[model samples]
Target: MSEHVDVLIVGAGLSGIGAACQLRAGHPGRSVAVLEARDVSGGTWDLFRYPGVRSDSDMFTFGYRWRPWPSETALADGPLILDYLRTVAEERGVDRLIRYRHRVVSAAWDSATARWSVVVDHDGVESTITCDLLWGCTGYYDYERGHRPEFPGEESFAGQVVHPQFWPEDLDHTGLDVVVIGSGATAVTLVPALAEKARHVTMLQRTPTYIIPQPDRDPLAVALRRLPERVRYPVVRWANVLKLVANYQLAQRFPAQARKLVRRLAEKSLPSDTSYDEHFQPPYDPWDQRLCVVPDGDLFRALREGGASVVTDSIETFTPGGIRTTSGRELAADLVITATGLELKLFGGIEITVDGEPLVASETMAYKGLMLSGVPNFVFTIGYTNASWTLKADLVGDYVVRLLDFMDARGLRTVVPVREDAVGERPFMDLQSGYIQRAVAWLPRQGDRAPWQLKQNYFVDVRTIRRGEIDDDVLAFT
Candidate 1:
């Protein structure tokens, strides 16, 4: 027999748990169930087990608004993040509503019944669950596989190759020479962490990425912790938000000045002998791609202490023991760690069909960065690329609950964003990163105007999503 529910939440991660908590608080009568593909609840936090895996953004904004993050540390590690997520789930009884290993394969919407028939794969068994509303909290990355670029002569490499996404537990790197391929957040993080255990660590990148050094513990948060969480949470959260906004604006408005400022800051953390322009300076301006944050200047410290090194070059081929660069330089390594990047996938690779017709994500336009145009009774959580993901995730959860409440008061069964005209379409994410650019063809498009265009700013999103009118003309109700 098919199970029935008022709402079926896909992916029991940070967003899913937040959504469930919001639903419980706002609409207590609604029957909600969360379907998790993985055995564990913490999605990204649980999936990535690599050394020095931590939040790129500060925990103050990264954490949910409703639940105050207890840690004084602005940046937290994977285990701590996982613990926080699990605590929220177990404490709120959201764990009871989740079905582990229940991977959603397809969702078919029936206009006649105004419900979604979701087909889920539970281990090897397949089952169906019908729901009035389907909320997709599955993040925009392929958890099954990280992006591994095919290097020439990779088959000839004798050493064990590893990806940060699927880090092996028993793969010992003690006193071994490690070469991490990528200059993004993961590469920067792993370099310092691995430098402690490995004999030497090298961060190999084709081009440089903007790196910023930040204090692991926020001084403001440290002082605020003396007070109660009720008094401290909002104060710290807003202060961090304001700081983020000011920094973002400075980067956007004055690119050259911002770039110089960031480079200067990074130079201070690096060795006095090392040239910042050669190793630390990126080709693009600030915020062109996401900046890598090094907590307490860990990466720079590793470099200064001669534990790690950075090489900016293109890989010609993977040699038997290491990599040969285009610049005729060969780097020897015992282990080649591909910190390359993630493969972006939407809705956990679930196929969506409405009235027996398949829906293409790229063809559809995103409505307010949450719902897709022409998609009914469905909402997906997508956070800001430039800011803390959970900040937008919390807002999305609140907005969704508000939308549901609006529907309940009006006796509406279906809600979908209807396109009024042929709006000019642009890429969903305005990032210049390799992973985002490569996946643009498969991702959704954004319109040239409001309601269809995504406001990447959290401050703007808060006002628009939380305080803006829900009964807009663009959204059709039935």
Candidate 2:
């Protein structure tokens, strides 16, 4: 059986939930349905169950703009984030519209009918659904399995090895020597949390990453909580946004000065004898890759208290009980954790076809960072890399609603971006991170100019996506 709807939203995560709420409020007459591959509604929050799992970005800006976060704490844990997501879905009646375990396999658009034929795999059964428009909110990573680099002698290691993505519940690390691989946010977080239970925790990294301590509780947020929700939310939200923007601009304009300031702050957190430049200082400038956040200086405190340590070197091979580095030094461990990184996946690895022709992402240029060139009646929500993800996500939801309203008013059946001239092409993301570099070939390209290039700045995106004109010459409506 084939079910039909006015709009079909993929994924039931933060972006999807926000999009559903916006659609319901703006166009109540439009019938909508959400397809979630997982059984739970909290996408990333529900998937990651590792120790000390929390948001790297502050909650005030990371949270939805429409709703004020009830808690005053800026950095939140996984459970609290999941609870907030559930609350939003239930309160807005969006939960009832979601179909769990329905993974979208492929979507084909027909210009003749102006509808999309979507195939979904529900458990072991195959089903079909048709919709006038398709909105993709699946995050930019592979959820089924995280990226795992192959070690030369991984099988020779007698100790228990675990990846944070597939952490076992029954596994115990208490009183065990643990070595966590990588120096990203997950590695920094796990080192501090595991130090509490383990005999010792060692964070092994091939290269250094920028780390900064953030206040776990915001004093201004706490003070503003006493006022009404309407007055407190906007004030706190803009304050955090401006602070982030100013810091980013400073880093770009004065890289050397910004680097020195970050190093000084990191040194203050570490012990007097420890060398901050040897391990904490990254080779790349600040904002090249995302800056790691440690709340209340937990990671530094662990190092100072002799609970955890760090080693910067490449791994040669895994030995019987530990790993041997390229420097020929061996670190013994009873447990090895790979917190390496994520594997980028576009549109939940779903295939897309338009009028019987396959659509290659790399060949298409992004249109306003929301829609793709020559792709009709389709939109994908991707957030900024430098700022809170939800900040751009909220704007995307609002812009989608506006686009739909415009189409209805004009009695248009299809819309797509048509490039009129040749524009210089660049990679989708400008970051030098490994994950992005590995997936560059599989991702889409961006133009050098506006409306075609991705403006990662949230303030610039707000002006263009929020108040910009929808009826441009580049956009063709039929």
Candidate 3:
């Protein structure tokens, strides 16, 4: 006898837990099982144990819409975020539904039976589980490792090289000089954090990223703390949502003005000796890439205090003492941290086949950025790149729930999003981030029209996904 599940969800991260919770709340009778590739429940949070791994987005919008966490801290540490995810899962009984260390290998859908044969690697032993509907929540990164580019002559450095993804818990940087390469969110976050204990820290970057500062405490959360949970959560959440939308819109509309504002802020925070043009200015316009957020100007404060410094140049090679720049400048350091970026991997690298035919992701179109066209009884999530990940995740969860409800009401066994009209293709992600650009070719493409393309704006998605009709011309029901 073969064990079969009707709704098998892959991953136990925020999106997975949110998906299960939505099913529990909206359709209590539905059976859902969550499969986590790792032993722990919190995916990214559990994996990242670095000194200052924290969320760049505010917790108000980052947290789930169905259940908001108690903490309202604007930018929360990794541990806190992990704890919140675990607590939410436990409180809603989603934890009981998760089977850890059961990594999905492949899923093949058979139209005749309307069931999917899912191959999973459980504790190194291969096992197959069948499902009527498959939901992918593994997120868009490889869990085992991150993107680590080999620097020329790195073996000659004779110093410790650490990647933020697999941060060693026992590694200590206290009283040691550290050189962190890359200017993304990880580098910005780690510079000040390592500076607090390390003798000195240098942020080495090929190019500059827009770094801005925001308050540690959320103004709305503090001001609305006196209000009831029902009133406060929604008020604060929506307010922040609108605020983010407006800011993103403004940046997109007037990129030059936005760039000038960022430059002015950086100039004021940084010391007079630091050249804003040389060390802080980026080649791209604002919103072309994500703006790194530093809480309370910690990064700039560290630089001003001489605890850390920024070096802007391409790498020539690694020297015995430290990194050698293309300008022939050598940065001496005892430790080297490569905060490069994530290795983008979709659906936990699971192979998908429809009726014995292999489904190539690049050949398909993303339907609402959630479901793939021509794939039946299947849905996947790719969160908002500009805003909080959960904002789009919550909307996707709702869409899946509503989709299930529609199928059940019509006595349908399968649903597939099929596009007939011709539309221009675009990359899955809008951001020009290095990680996305590197993996965009393999990822699925999005159409230029509605129901086929993602608006990315939270308000537009809420209307289309949350309350929109499910029985549209695009979705074929059987």
- What are the models' TM-scores? 0.99, 0.98, 0.98
The collision pairs in model 1 are none
Prediction-by-prediction clash tally: 0, 0, 0
Model-by-model lDDT, in order?
0.91, 0.91, 0.91
lDDT for 202 in candidate 3 is 95
lDDT of 2 by residue, 1-478 (tens): 6899999999999889989998998899999999999998988999999999999989999889998888888889889998999999999999999999999999999999999999999998989999998999998999987889998899999999899988898988999999999999899989999999999999999999999998998778988778988998899999999988888888988999999989888889998767788899898999999999899999999999999999999999999989999999998999999999999999999999999999899999999888999899999998888889899899989898899889989999888998657788989998888889999997998999988988788788888998899997889999
**Reference-based TM-score, model 3:** 0.98
Q: Model 3, 260-324: lDDT tens per residue? A: 99988878999878888989899998889999999988999999999999999989999989999
The alpha-carbon lDDT assigned to residue 13 of candidate 3 equals: 93
Candidate 1 structure quality by residue, lDDT tens digits, 1-478: 8999999999988899999988888888899999999888999999999999999999999888999998899889999999999999888889999999999999999999999999999989999999999999998999988999999989999898999999999989999999999999999999999999999999998889999999999889888778988999899999999988889878999999999899888988888877788877888888889988989999999999999999988999999989999998999998999999999999999999999999999889999899998899999997889989998898888888899889989999999999767688989999899999999998999998888888688878888898889998999999
Off by over 4 Å in 1: none
